[model samples]
Target chain A: MSGGKLITGFAVTATSHTLGEYRARGGYQALERALLGMKPEEVTGEITASGLQGRGGAAFPVGRKWSVIRPDDGETHYLCANADEGEPGTFKDRWVLENAPHLLLEAMLIASYALGVRHSFVYIRGEFDLAYRRLAGAVEEAYGAGLFGKDIFGSGFSCDVFVVRGAGSYVCGEASALITSIEGKKGYPRNRPPRLTVRGLYQKPTVINNVETLANIPWIIAHGAQAYRTFGTTKSPGTRLVSVSGHVTRPGVYEVEHGYPVGRFIHEDCGGVLGGRALKAVIPGGISTKVLTASEIEPHRLGHFGDCEDRRVLPQSAGIPHLEPLVFEGESLQAAGSSLGSGGMIVIAEGTCMVRVLQVMLRFYHHESCGQCTPCREGMGWLHRIVDRIVSGRGRPEDVDRLYEISRANDGTTICGLGDAAGYATVGILDKFRCEFEYFIAHGRSRYDGCLECLGSS
Target chain B: MKHLIPECEALKARLPQGFESTLVLPCLRRVQEERGYVADGDIDALAQYLGVPRVQIEEVLSFYTQFRRQPIGRWHLQACHNVSCSLRGAGSLLDRLRERLGIEPGQTTPDGRFTLSTVECLGSCGTAPVLVVNEVYHESMTPEKLDALLEGLE
Candidate 1:
């Protein structure tokens, strides 16, 4: 709440998602202001200055992705909103879709004007019923109100939005695969040299952006980039929608500023670990980003960790030079050897089996692997089988090393980032809790008495 | 198939030009909605109707998990067994249901009322241990709640 709400400024009501409610909240004004007043390059210039990072997972700069297109280049441009929110433990986009759909639409309209897009698309996963309905409804309303079509607000800029729904394929969440999916093909990621902006979506210049990243455009265009910079840390301009789940008492979506401390965000904002349990580890971002142990997050809580001899209590190695300084930003987290990838924080409480947790993560990677690349297709299965063997009480001492070897094989071996993502998750957990894997292998069962679920529930 | 000529033409008209293949997924979904599963004849007919290759339709059908080839039971139970749900007894929840139905994940019950399956993350981790029966989500599930849901189902 401290960073200041932009898209979610209005409270949720029965009529909140309606176009009338959105117009009352001053929606589409950004489009009016942009079309009637500014040139295409000027809008893109403002976005580049805002430093808005991609909210999908990879913190790629949005403006940099947009800057590649020239509106007057005589080539038809396509702007796509990647609403395939399939990342595990990430549902923040669903919030925007269900509540502030018009914000995304208005933002898309402004983006279309900036990019010279005549036809745009929104590719959302099929699992989302309510979210899809709301977005489709918003699109219909806009078209009916003359917001879409040949001329809008007498600006002569013609744009139309098509809502393309995807079947249940996680790989389609990838940019090239999303385009391929929209093209009515198997969702296979294309090798880059064409880089989407060059040749994409029926072999034309296309710009695919994450849902949350595009939602910030209206805010940036409404107020200048300089004013947007006044919100969060200069390095990470504006707030992030963090979807916290797992052992947190209040497991929901939260709008956190960039520089907000992870410790305070978890302990105070999320109401701490459920059942007053001590925090064990935090998977900062999706399952792909590296896992941060409890002490690594709050290095100042040395007193809380108590014993210096305990292997998990050492936060000094987290690379924090000052006290209470670890905050939720891209630069700082990257410096600490992790990232805020997708802002899907899965909080773990004490008394949970870290080995079992890794097993779950590996299983996801295995199941969701697109099978397009050899390394991901086979290596994911290898890792999943090894973890399954370890969890099933037949794990060998060499199995841990085998897991690492398979993880190494998976790194950079795939067409998309899925292979590397699996490797990072496997290594991140093994690096932090090698002892748990060893114990589970040696004892043929989990040493910890509990799982990722709450113990109070029967 | 003969009766569906107008429906196919209307659907083809609604989609974009030169992208006739894009209608493969939507055609499969529409057929599946009407018939529970997309039969081989349906695929062949859709290929002829949409002017796309049969292999293209087949690949798209097999590539996505949503486009099923087999007939599903009345209650298609898909339980999420990912990290958040795994933490919140998703495995146990599946185990209980599996035991009650006496079938594996891909198997249908003898009564033809239930087919249990494990799914990846449904993106509702806040309410862990989620179960979806015929496209409707049942979250924060308990043993009693699951049993009652089965009882209430026709």
Candidate 2:
């Protein structure tokens, strides 16, 4: 097995975030090992070999991203950790920042060395109060120990880490917009013919990785890539820090291996849905990815999208675990028409209204649209207005089709993923729960009480 | 606004080389830190101090939602009305604050003790129903808890 767990394998005391405590738990060894022993190509090669996927919603492989920037490319490259954890339900990166910040700093240093980056930056969100303080404090500590500055570990490779905080803009979490924010401009996302890896921050080659994605680099470097691959499934190859909220009984961050069943994670690890009510739906990631109904998540047990539920037929099904009901990792969930995005699972209970849920989701997309593209800017507001009127007792049967039309309009029409993502969440909910929207539009009110809270069954 | 000269100078002295444009957000943060909000006079002085145009400063504060132009009350209550928080009674939570303060969102109380506004997300979804009073976060808040929080503020 790998030396320590992927991240957060240490006993977290009150002072564990300190450099001394971190070193005691073997924290900066990955950077030291990579700097003194391995070449830059080898460091990135280990990451590529490990198959570590990006934890920021999109499951892009981390290795493919690093490969874009050649170490000997003869250009000033930048490394950025997107610490703006603005996705509504995702706060796993904040866990690494508040309690395990040195892990991130050390990981960024390893990545910087690999990418030939002289200077790197972390564009943290402005609203992150404690995470900012802890990260800044860790950076100061790393500098004090000579771990960050000139000739780190006497490898003759030098890099500096800068914490450039954002001023409460969600779109800045996007790589291009984040670089733009760092350049001290309005946080509007730019067109991307030149990927950030090609012409990025200051018009130079830059590599931006999500905080959790970068946090895994030290582990991959410390242990060989082959050892790292042993942790999760062949494709996913690591544990994801799932931040569950909403109606879960015990809601917080739990590190689930990629092949771990989603049902077990929610039911056992998270203490099941709140008030012990029947499960209604789960927003598998943030409000961006598709929402999975209870049956969809437990598709093998009760067939929603045509997986065998009959006991006689289930025994013959080869890869499908009918008895266990496995919805493991990204591909498994994607098969159920959703993605394990950013590992943010918001569990919705039986009594919750889908219209109210979509209204909240639409309102978020509308408020956070950055207004860079006309499709997203107009489509988001239009989607929100339609849902708002439906919740406000204005009955129109045409509204559901209009919602679908608006969602269809947003697909691939915007510069950033926010537009397309908002559409995914809307269509996902609408696809699963069309009757609720239709009922609300026809009757000018929600079929249920519009209750999101789980008042326990009497 | 004239009292913010020292803060502006401090911001100017610390900006990274050739990245004077980066001073935009930090400068606005500084002004808001000194004064309760970024007034028009403060923006003019900041633009002049940092040598960034007034338009850049204007677009900045206008873009980021946290930076307020007008002066707000002592206790700025930001209730998260996003999915997780909304699922956990953030709607009624906002309603309760409105009843207690006798002011809707974007309005301050008659005495200027409280100002209410709904934020998109505070990222504390685990402890849903989050309410941010100034910089601190009050998570999984109830109407009773909010009432107590308001009482203790004075």
Candidate 3:
């Protein structure tokens, strides 16, 4: 609401997904500009100058990611746009995939040209029927219009984009796991050291980007780096498409600049909590982020968790204390022990029990674990069982400590970030709402009078 | 093995000859789509058709939760029981479903008309309390609306 519409401009148009409508809006012009006038390196340079970062959970610099690719190294390179929006409370990518399919394709074309990728894949979630249908249609339209395949735009650069549907695996959102899924295997993440950049997707150099991250490519190409940086903060620049849901009166996707406040986002943009109820807590990013209380929501701070010494621990250590706290919409959600992951702000109204929230989160992580690592596979289920007991009024006071210990041990013990996500998801809730767990153990009921039955028992 | 399903020939003809293990997931999906669910015989037939090891094909089948190993009823109701949906009374909605259908989560009615289950998240949290019946999403689900949806579904 605060920033001008960059990505979601065509969301309301009924025929926005069509290539005709997209071309009418000057869609593939960025590809033409990059392919005809500028060199691939120049395109990557512009993106690096724009200070664009991945809009996915990990905010790695997008241009830097492209800069790492050895385009002319004679080895086949692949690019994948991660469209598996499986993260709970995050649906912004779905919006782009459904409404602006060609924008993503056009962006993919520019990115593939820059990265020297011949064949690319959009690994979309199978559940997103509309996105798949529209994207498949868009790809066909591009192929037919001479926009894709065999020296596109007569620029001597050829790239083919394929849409690979994922079969309901949350772990596939991770890059390596997605590659594995594309190879027709279980979506288990491989250990690093041989990063996906080096050997990925059938043992070739690969670049996996988020759908929203790729969508920004054409805009940056058309408008230039300086114009792109004018919207967001210096450190984390550009307008972000946030999906605000849960307890909000007007719950949907909103495009806002980096410095916008979290409170205003919930109050002004989202029309506050449903039925004008008092706000209890907000999960600034997705369910993976720790829940932020109403008071903490006033200063919505945003920062990449990568900068910290330990992302699992809150009140970021003195690793870079001198650096000014990166502001997300004018507030520090991080300072309050949370993050703006995937821009999925889930607002919790009053009368909701914190114990129930933790239970649901733990259960999700438990179900999604790929069973590759001992700590995450076993530890997640253990944590879920402990929370399940506490919610059912069969919990011991020691169960809370057990939950914290399990989470702490699970952090950073797996090949992928899913383990850290599981640990952080539970530990943050416990740190913020220990009282709710205590009350449940003592009085055999949630502080907010939630259902005492173990919802996580199944 | 019994004759492969009719779609199996078309799926096989589309393949680039020989067995490409990468096509296992897509083949299984197609088999499941043509037929309601991937039965054991179908797995054997697909393994024979694709020349893939039955164990390997089974691994793919078990890895993804979407590939139904057993037959599903006409109305396969999956409700989101994650945080957002749970906050919006998914628990009670789930309970109401159990009461109306006379089956717990993951159980099918004796009549084979309804099979109820729960999922982590449908990614439709904005419209919390979302329910998916046969891959079609029904958002903002309530007891009354669920009853009406079921009534209209057959």
Candidate 4:
């Protein structure tokens, strides 16, 4: 609550909130400065010192990504803004595009200048027409203002941002997959080492930054590294836009410092769960990560882990949202065994059948599987079918072990994180809530005792 | 409308030759944006300008949900039918629109005032149960809002 204005620095102004409004409010001022006065390395150094990390789920350091791009090597270096915000329950980036398009545009211009790239693309999801339109409109506005096209702000540095629409693939959110999509290919993720920064977007050095991460850059440049660092923990440094959803009374986006407590985010910011229902479980990051129960939530106060010694604490990337009227925690969620993915906290209220909930999620992962990887495609379908059988009251005891086996084999075999996501969800639910699963298998009913009629329908 | 048509023609002239696939969809999108739907002659003219086979252009246009193959009403109503929208009562909203429009999905009303269509996703999931009338997004849609929205169009 008490922090310098890093992420939400320009969010409050009413008129300049739109692209035209942003230009009037000195929105692309940083890009002009970067192009006119500073060298690429100087801009990169400022970002490195600012401690900005990729906000597109991975949380990779932005400066480090820029450092990897060698402008002197001089192939066509690409700068991609990862706008494929497909993570379940996360919509903060969409809000940024809708409200502050020029911020992201300015950030990209600065980033492209630092990377010495002329051709940059923002690979936005196809579903985000509004964002696409806003970005396109912003680009035109910037061009007309002579703030984006050649010799921007009277400097020799030149860069152009093109918006490419993605065909609704979640995997494309990954940097490699995003590059592939921009290259007019199927959006499958590529292996690293020959990473995107080294060989991306037509085999050139490309720096891919998330929308929120790029939006933070203009502020970082304007306010200086120390000013940016004043907000969050030393390692994390700066505010983040957390998209809190689920059973909470006021489920919406909140701009909080990096190290803000999860409990405050949930109880104070999100207005707690509706009807005073007990918090059953929380999928911290996105649904991809494992679930954390109440006991786990109670002890693990959210903070940044900057040093190697700090690794003992919880990783800062795990999105923190407090679940009130604590229902499940500790060994229960760990027993469920899912990681907190993209801070897409879905607080399952009490009385909702656990098996049914898992089934719905399983069906989603199953349907969304791109089918390129055998383990993920086949294994997800297998788990979904088994969960479906169980939910429909025809589950066999062997189905539990089968789910575990399929999930284990699926974990590391696939090309992308989608495999791990499916594996984690399946194994986490079974491991953390084995008794509930067993009760369903034996009695052909939910152990929660409130949803008998809901069960009867299945 | 005439001013918009000349603008469309200029945009069509800018399409690169032999790269018909890329320009076709964008041209169709432009025409739809201006006129509310892509008329057949417009598609034919677009095909001629881009130097692509009309069938190829038509196929690509038909593939994307955003491309309207037939002439619709003065206003276009696209309801979001993706997972988030589905969870937030987009189905009920669509049902209400269909009842109010007196036309089923993909059909324009008899008065040529509106056309109803269900789209994959509109990407405003936070404000779920959303719909787009022309280019403007209407969020947190209800039956009452739908009625008011239709009335406003009139």
Candidate 5:
């Protein structure tokens, strides 16, 4: 709440997306300064010092990722801008694509130079038409202005950026799957002992970073590391774009610094729940993360890792509308089983059935599973079928334990993280809402009929 | 062997070097866009153009849900029936569409004007119960709106 915008400062302005308007707002200055003044190593150094984490739910250090690319290994180096944001309830990447396409271009330029990548690809989601159009226009403008192609701005660094559209698959967002998709395959994830850093596109060194993470690079390079560090907590030192939706009165994307309280994000930023309904649950991240009960989230506490050693105590600025920073007092949501995955904050109000929610989420996993591993392919369908049975009138009493057992079995057995994601989603939902599942099994109806009763409950 | 489609040859020529494998998804998309579905003839033509096996091409086509092997209706209605949309009553909407259209999700109407399919999340959760009709998104959909949309389609 107290932090200023770094990545999205130009999003709300009346400026057109032309290079002229972007230049007027101090845009591309970072790319210019980094290209002219700083060494490639220094650019990576500044990023590492800033403690910027990957915004694509992994939270890995951005600098460390850039550092690993063996740019001088005598092999072709490729950089992939992971814009294929397919996680449910996450659309923050679309903002940069729709509003500030040049930011991404500039960031890509800096990243390509730092990583020694000559060819790059923006693997965007297929549904993002406006983003694709805007980015295509920006790439054209950059090439026309000599920001791309041979001898960019007289820096002698040449890179070509291509925007690739994903056909339609959530699993393609995974790094390996994205690589496979780029290779014109079926988007099935490859087993990873040889990570993309070593052998990627065209069997070359590749570095894939999220769209939001790359957007932050221009800011860190333009502003010094210390200046960038002043925004958020020490460990998570950046403003994150949180997409808050579902049952909130004013659901949209809000750019809040890391360690901002989740309760404040809901009550203050999102205008609280719709119809003044009592909060039942909150999916703090995307649907892939565990759901947290309303009572589990402490009010005015910045959502951060509680048991993890990376906890930072934030200060309560004047008029910031929060209590003392949500410190690592005890076991927190991460300890209770959840993560800040992709910052897709979905607030669930009272009268929404947890069993129904799990069923819906499981259906998505079942549909999106690539069928590579048997455990995930079979387990997701089993979990979905069992949940569907429970939601309907034909659920057996033993189905709850069966659901838990299947979910546990599928967690770590797949070649990709989709298996773990599909398995772990049942943890918090079943743990917090066991009574709802029991209610559905006993009475053949939901404890709350918030949506509809069309699933054969009668 | 059937004659190769001219569009497939043109698309193959347009692809960048070393990106031959990357042509499958985009080529399939293009074929679907022009022909309404990926005909078997296009696959054979692509196999010839890209020099990949025909079974290999079929395998790629079968993996992604967006590709269709047969013809579809003029207006393909892809309703987001995933978690976010379902939480907002996308199920009831789907049921209404099914009842009105008198066909299942994978089936097209006899008149070939509409085809309904329930898809995963479309990344438009802010506007839940979203419907994507022929690549254009119609969000925050309701029963009346669906009826009006169906009426306006034909």
Candidate 6:
């Protein structure tokens, strides 16, 4: 399908079946166009105009990120694509890597040209063997095509990309932690000050872009600034791959123009909830964000869309948020104390227990906690135990208040976002679903039908 | 025998001179990359070169999932048994492999052609119920595909 048109190239086709298919579909035509004539700044400007942003949860502008890496540093600059997609309910990057490997490679090459980087790495999650292999194969294909190594498109700019596997650690999704893992060290996050763009990966200036962020580069370069900014709202522009899973009939990745309505995407694109079950709640941006109930999604107020002025142009401000009864215009879902994280929209169906869901999420955080900070290490385990007790038919009215206190203490004290994830779940569930939790505690079972079964299986 | 004795003697020269904590893992990794498994004396030499006690290196080799202390088969098949993969039938895949190979999780075939092991998360939860054979990932595995894959490998 011709999803969109490229300025310097032909139509952007979705022939992402294989590497050869991608090439035939005019996948790396932008990179060839770029190497033939386009200057580095020209590419960066085009991306900036396109309003592309990091797709690995933090929606930072891609153009701004490229502009930050000064060429005068004279040190080897690294382009690390954060493919460690650990966010629950998010599977878009994997699909891209598996299907459209060349797109990512082409984007990385263009990004390297912009940043004057010679070496790059695709930091894929260790478990994503398919993505890792596909990326590795794509790199080899690029090398064979003379798109990488020594000289690219006969332009003196030489770049080599490697795919590095990360041992299963969610914290490695953080740039510093990723760098540490690449350096063969334990994947622990470093406090930000020098920032990754300034001093990262062997203490040299580095730019860490998300998989989708890099994938957007070729599109930006091929489509001029004005052409790329034709879609989405004024601030956020461009199309994004939204990964919607859980309780939806048509759960999969959907590539939509920015500013697309959440209700439209969910009801139309996803075929609505399975069995026509009413939506009970939704976690808009992955599992970390606060949960919003069905009432919140009815009016479509809380959904996140790319802010843009022009029609048909999409920008980097693309995000995932639950559609609420409110109109989503200027205000951000994050302003409501929940972020549109990684475009992982998990829908909670009617008869699904919210407290049980929170308990499951809490258990995940507890297991994944790196134990670097005292609060996260200790607090997560404590929360898990308390929730376990409650779920096992043990009751204490004060436990709800205790859960809030524990989550509050762990929120800002951790070395990474894991603490926040645990804390957010704790606070969100307690505040929004307290009655359900209380009912469960009082009756030693869930108030919702089949909730006990859900708890048992979950 | 004389050459071996002299090399052993050179170990004394190597032991104290610029002695550093040897990364036996890297050496073992290199050896495995080239030969697929550690040889008899490679471990001892690596220990001597690293200047750490042999048992320490052995403990490290045994601790991590990547390093295999003993000889493995030609193909190392590790099925991820973590939550995500488990939720998607990774355990069943393991069982299928075990039934076919006639061995348990850590056992190698008598012919030394394949070894089965269950690992923690391999990070591809999006494509659950995955396995890695000689570091090549096979995703969304079904019983039929597993049988075909095993047969092809053999």
Worst 10 residues of 5 chain A by lDDT: A310-319
Higher-scoring candidate on DockQ, 4 or 5: 5
List DockQ, one per candidate, in order: 0.66, 0.67, 0.46, 0.16, 0.47, 0.12
List candidate 5 segments past 4 Å from native.
A11-15, A299-333, A450-458, B1-17
lDDT of 5 by residue, B42-96 (tens): 8877887777778877887888788888888999999887766775668878988
For A226-287, candidate 1 gives per-residue lDDT tens digits of 98998889899899999998988888888888899998999988888888878888888989
TM-score of each: 0.95, 0.93, 0.91, 0.77, 0.90, 0.76
Model 6: per-residue Cα lDDT over A262-339, one tens digit each: 666677777876567666667777777777655455545433221111212312222223334422222345544565
Q: Which stretch of 10 consecutive residues in model 2 chain A shows the poorest summed lDDT?
A: A306-315
lDDT tens per residue, model 1, B62-132 = 88988888887899999999888887778789888987789999899888999888998888888787998
Lowest summed lDDT across 10 adjacent residues in model 2 chain B is found at: B8-17
| TM-score (C-alpha, index-matched) for candidate 6 | 0.76
| Candidate 6 lDDT tens digits, B1-154 | 1124353444233222232332243345555566666665766776665566777656545433465546789888888664445435565788799999999988899999999987654544445567889878887677788998988886
Best by lDDT: 1
Q: Per-residue lDDT for B52-131 in model 4, tens only? A: 67776665454434556567787888886644454455667888887777888778788888877766434555566688
The local distance difference test score of model 6 is 0.68
Better of 3 and 6 by TM-score: 3
* i-RMSD of model 3 (Å, 1 decimal): 4.1
Interface RMSD of each: 1.6, 1.8, 4.1, 5.7, 3.3, 7.4
* lDDT accuracy of residue A85 in candidate 5: 89
Cα lDDT for residue A320, candidate 4? 36
lDDT comparison, 4 vs 6, better candidate: 6
**How many clashes in each structure?**
2, 0, 14, 23, 0, 31
- Against the true structure, whose TM-score is highest? 1
Instruction: Flag regions of model 3 displaced more than 4 Å.
Output: A299-331, A451-458, B1-19, B48-52
Selected candidate, larger DockQ, 5 vs 6? 5
Docking class of 3: acceptable
lDDT values of the candidates? 0.85, 0.84, 0.80, 0.68, 0.78, 0.68
